[model samples]
Target: MNSLFLAFIGVGMMAAGFALYSRFLGSKVYRLSAKYATPAHTMEDGVDFVPTNKYVLWGHHFTSVAGAAPIIGPAVAVIWGWVPAFLWVTLGTVFFAGMHDLGVLWASLRHRGQSIGTLSGRYIGARGRNLFLVIIFLLLLMVNTAFATVISKLLVSTPTAVIPTWGAIVVALLIGQAIYRFKWNLPAVSVVGVVSLYTLMVVGDRFPIVLPETVMGIPDRGVWIILLFTYAFAASLLPVWVLLQPRDYINGLQLFVGLIILYGSVLITHPDVVAPTFNDNVPEGTPGIFPLLFVTIACGAVSGFHGVVASGTSSKQLDKETDARFVGYFGAVGEGLLSLGTIIATTAGFKTLANWEEVYNEWSAGGVNAFISGGGSIINEGLGIPTSLSATILATMAILFAATTMDSGVRLQRMVVEEIGQIMGLKISALVATIIAVGVAFALTFSSGADGSGGMLIWPLFGTTNQLMAGLSMAIIAVILTHLRRPAWPVLIPLCFVVTVAMWAALLQLGTLWAGRNWLLLGIDVVIIIAAIWVVVESASAIMRARKAPAVAWSDADTDAPAPHHVG
Candidate 1:
């Protein structure tokens, strides 16, 4: 099969899903209305709740939720075969991720932009809310720790990316100052920001910066990890407009350009699909593809972490309720396109089946490195760009993505920590909360000494834990819809599917952990499974209670103020 044709089919499916299906969702299901003033207006603080342009907000939302998972997950999962990974990315993005992301955004908007974890108490119960917080905290911790390791390793391996990767922070700070302080035109600022970012990439490619093996007695990777968390701590403390918003916005634009380069390479080169559609010969010890495939490819398809990002940060910055469709749904489509590109690069970018097999000899072999090398090759062959520059560009893309996500994840974790403090009858300041969040992440990263390899220890649980988080988020949305007496099957159906699959995957992981005598992970996995099951029970009960209660009449009137118990 021709890679170009497969790529087009995947892109076409996502396009139709956004164009036709998202419309049905916006009007008929979510019933989004511009009249609904989002928290950005109602609670307009200079810090976290300032009204934002939809495009800029979409950039922030898209890149923050993207992280490196979409690239890493699909790039690795193609080991099963391109057919399954491609189908799941397209279909899951359309029916599962689009609705999940958009729904969480809408739910948060209608409730004063409270996070899904906080909203759980109002709809589900105090107990459910507490458990939801646990899931969210764990997920954020995993993201921060794991991504630090990913970024650190990339920095060590691809020294050329170092300058651009860190230089992007300066570009974003300037973009923020230009837009918010100088009041420059947004389009002009955006063009300058993107061009500045790319220029840094080129300069970095020409002059690489390799750190010594030991930087003041710390290994290079460990030093990078410490520096990354330190930056994240500061970035999380700054106001959104100062760093978070602009950094994510520019990174999002740069990422789209990178995607176009990748997708365009496929169309221009018309490479052959060298890997099999379905691999009958499986690597020993590789788990069955059924449930694992769904969890492995969570980000590009459907992810609970997206819910955390949607409700936690994005909703607070949303200027209008209607922008949720674009920022939330279309943002999901953007990631699906990236994931689709990964599938193509890994499966078809290689020259032959034997070459592809060499890279996929083991279950864990194909990851971000595979995507960088393979996709870099395609770009070099198709566009006549040098491989070194292409690799630098892609490496910078991955680094920027991970860094932005780390920014938001740390911020969100800080918010969660503050929430937990409130529950404990203690007041936690933002600075204090941020210190705790970053402190925990840093401790985990260096737990196995300064090498900073400990962060990946619990990463194996991220897939199941993340997918389950998505299901639990859907549970919150479904409960809210039932209370409002509106249609909920759109959320409910996917809710059921995701929860079932994730729970199954968690059980499978439990056995694997137990067999390996990995007691720590096994214990944590047990807690997550139990918390998820308990939340589902609470949500089911909440839905039943809502069905029996008086139904609030749905309305699109401008006067529909968000009420604690109802929205009519």
Candidate 2:
């Protein structure tokens, strides 16, 4: 198929999924009415109660939802054929993703906009909340490390992508500052930001940043890990308005513009997907089907990580209950759109290339593994960029995307872990707290991307784990919607299905990797397997407990209704 045609089909499906699934049915399930929902939920001097606008809320919600997992998962899953990658992204978004996201926001609405973690305490009971926190804290840790590995590879490989990415961010920050502080018109500032991003791209193409010789002294992989850690630390300590939020908004804009450029380029060129979406035989070492494909293509379908975003950080900043459904469900649709774009780019110039297997193997050199890991580089050559430069550009894109997510993940993990630590009477100081958070992040980053596998197997684990989390979240939402006794089936059916599939996938992975007994793989498998089982058990218990609770009349208080009671 022509890459252009595929792009159109995939995008159309994504749009249709949002319209048919989320706008009409999901909106009903997650109902976001402004009047009944509290904004500040009793404002506090610091933390949890900060009032934020929908735009900035977009930054928090989107960056949370958008991460390294999407790019990596689809790239590897394409090993099974684009059919699974494209279908999972499209269908999953409509039925399952929309429900999970909207449900998360809906549950938060009941506790005066409290986070899912907090609501678990009040609604599900103390033990469920504790169990939820343990999963969440560690999930954030894995996320931080995974993204760190992604970025380090990108920085080392793609010298040119830096200037444009960082420049777009600086431009975004200045514009954000001008708008929020100086009271500039948002539309005008946004336009400037767009223009600046393009200019940065042009210059980045002309003169991308290269790593210094000293930095390059270390092995190509080792240098990347060190640089990534240093970058993560700097990013964590900075203020959100300056780099965090603005960069996110810009990233969203970049997502929009880059996708358009991709679609347009394909339309003009009419490039064929030269290689079949899936390879015929598995690579020498990798498995050919089923379990691996399910693990590899995790983000396209469902992710455990999204749950953390939905209930943990984004919930804290929601201004109205209704907005949560829009942000949560729709944001995922947008991310689906992103994965589709990467697929198109990989397939775009395939017609001219020979020896697809050789090209696909080269992708592992850098972060190109995330976008074109199993695919040939026919598209890269067709773009008129040298193979090396094309690879660098791809690497830069992944690294920047990973950097944005890692910064946010570390901060979130810090918040949750610190909260837990304080409750445990650990007496951690502010500086010590910073170390604890960064310490965990560093531990995860140390040997990441080391296997020359370029972060493929790990991605499925990320996806499965993330999906498990989302499933647990869906369970919470299912229990809540059923308790409310408003039209529940629309969301609940998908809810049950996604959790089952995701849990099945995660458990399968943990076991497979454990049997493989690659120690690093084993460690990840163990952590995630335990977490998934806990979530599945918690979700099942939540459902049973809620079902068995004494019946309440229609429109009973959301809080007074029984919470999912599974706990530590």
**All candidates: CA RMSD (Å):** 1.6, 4.2
Clashing pairs in 1: 304-470
| Per-residue accuracy of model 1 over 1-568 as CA lDDT, tens digit each | 9999988899999999999988988998888998877788888898999899999999999999999999999988888888999999999999999999999999888878889998898888789999999989999999999999999999999999999999999999999999899999999999999999999999999999998999888999999999999999998889899999999999999999999999889889989999889988767777899899999999999999999999889999998889999999999999999899989989988999999998999886899999998999999999988999999999999989989999999999999999999999999999999999999999998999888998887899999999999999999889878877778999999999999999999999999999999999999999999999999999998888888878755454433334435322
TM-score of each: 0.98, 0.85
Once superposed on the true structure, which residue ranges of model 1 sit more than 4 Å away at CA?
A: 554-568
**10 residues in a row with least lDDT, candidate 2:** 552-561
Best candidate (score: lDDT): 1
Shift in Å, residue 347, candidate 1:
0.5
lDDT of each: 0.91, 0.61
Q: Local error of candidate 2 at 423, Å?
A: 4.3
Question: Clashes in each model (backbone N, CA, C under 3 Å)?
Answer: 1, 11
